[model samples]
Target: MTTPDVFMPRLPWDAVDPYPFYAARRREGDVVWDATAQAWLVLGHKVARNVLAAPHWISDPRANQAATAGRFFTADTVAANMLFTDGPTHDRLRHAVRDVFGHSFISQLTEGVESLCKQAISTIDVDEPFDVMSQIAWPLHVAVIAAWLGLDPAQCQVLREHSPAVIRLLSGITDTDTLHVGLAATTALITEFLPAAADRRAHPRDDLLSYLATAPELSLDEVVTTAILVAVAGHETTANLLGAALIRLITPTAEGTRLADHIDPADATVLTELLRLDSPVQAAARTATADQQLAGVHIRSGESVLVCIAAANRDPHVYPAPHQFLPGRPGPSPLTFGHGAHYCLGSALARLETSTALRHILERRPVLTATPAWRDTPAIRGPHHVPARFTA
Candidate 1:
């Protein structure tokens, strides 16, 4: 008789470097019981894709009792935003942003994006090791997103400072006080800025805010919420990706060198491969809308499933040498921006931003070298500090 598989104990390493843990689990099969988060961890390429694409999996935190129990999202203006909603509500709100964030619209911002990248890179000191996260990636992402959202430089700084806290709250990690402060900052900015922008757009202007303001059937609060969502979502995830990509570039590998040598930055395939090996957004939660069996595991209705994008990206079944940073590795794309109806509205913008920034870095500092003191955090996996010496 065949034996039932043994469940593994949850460890801190699972949070840190989940690739090895996921690889071990995937060996047993596509699905494994994750004791740490008390959810069925789906790891294989096909299973993960099915889970993400399935209509039965919902992104609304409110659908899961545990997800909404102590959250401040109930009080925040973000509650009106699409990120936390489902069904028609989500579709309508998402369309409002998606229209403006479409490929045709984002393509026009390439010059602005390239300018931001050049400006950020020009300021970096080539002779010394530097925190590229703070000096380059953060500023580039902030400037690009702010430009897209029609916020002035000063307001952009405010958003940048408060964004980490806001994202923490969204991730259900911050304390009540911290969450309140972040929410208040966001609300104040959106309330003040959106109305004026909306009014200007009604009269017609070139900026995105004007377009959003003039969009049919979208209300004032919807405009504000949409702008706020774009600013936060657009910047933070790409910022993380830039940092993670830099870490991969510094790692000793022939593939890394080849990636650095690729002159044309519009190569989405290479960037996608790098992202698959080292994904920025690690996990996203979804609640099952009904009792469903996924990859042989029974997922009850309303249970929260943490889709580990990082782990899934590295599934060996799909990606050979999955753990290695192979910039040219060919396979299915990673779920960094998610999939299906909820695919990131700002994905084109993000790709443009990252590719622009990386191209600038490579052109100027092709042989950048960093020290061994790079620190990786648990929740956000990237170099907290990347001390690098570059040749300009």
Candidate 2:
């Protein structure tokens, strides 16, 4: 078969520099259709905000399930979770998770998250190059989230190991092999958590699993699915976020100032800017529930709308100089964690993990020991490895 002449941004897909493609898309229109993705790309920040608010745009793929839609779970079970639902169902699922993850509730995890960060950093030699994703971010996040859910950290490591396929599925990669891998990994994740859920039911503890397993509002399947969702969403994205920030913030730019030098552990503002520069989940798709208007374009009912978060986050109209990576700069919070009712419930937890991890490295002044290797995937953009050695 011959390759189709598609309109997707051709170049820079694998490059560390993806801004030029995003910049060119913004010049085209806020809502331009990409035949390659078979979805409309939303690149303007303000337009993206509006698209998020529009009620007719729904996250459930069943609304217009593509022929090749990924089977991340038995579709019925996974669709019941907040990440893939809408309206009252989404609200209910969000509420169940939110009660435990609310700002004040999650603040309690800060002490533990910090301790985990310290533990991770201690494993690396003072002046030795280490892969931050594995050595620092992944284990630190997995441990914190596992402790919060009242599970053993060692088992939680499996969730991280199987997370890349989840990212691929969520970001709209629906190839057969990718879908198979995602389903297998997802099954493994749920199987690992099943015993935990059962144990929580027999002896209810004052922890996340106990609450979830016993919640009257959630079905048994919902409980298992939600646990898998939280396991991946809670840690994987944040690990990528941490890796992205470290690669971009610690390295010296042509201007010679580094973002790490100015990071404040308690400052959400700096985290916001960094999120815009290096988004964790780069793209997502929503099917139109009804014929509607989005970004001045007439989106037909049942059509797939692809929200290019990495593109929207870099819109010049939103950020004064969208291409430059500057921490602590003034800009609205990024769409990386998403917006409206579908916004990530674990946003606060992820930010806390990232900022805390960043502060630990900053205090010691880490140096990038080698060129960073970015994950060469279009759906999720982040560094595969960021090797650094603290020079304090």
Q: Which candidate is the best by lDDT?
A: 2
TM-score top scorer: 2
TM-score, candidate 2, is 0.92
Distance from true position, residue 244, model 1, in Å? Answer: 1.1
Candidate 2: stretches off by over 4 Å: 1-16, 65-67, 70-75, 263-265, 326-331
Checking candidate 1 for backbone clashes, the offending pairs are none
Separately for all candidates shown, the number of backbone clashes (residues 3 or more apart, or on different chains) is: 0, 0
What local distance difference test score does each model get? Answer: 0.68, 0.76
Model 2 agreement with the true structure over 82-176: per-residue lDDT tens digits? 77788888888878778777788788888888888889897777788788877887778788878878877557667777877776666544566
RMSD in order of candidates: 6.0, 3.0
Question: Lowest-lDDT window of 10 residues in candidate 1?
Answer: 6-15
lDDT score for candidate 1 against the true structure: 0.68
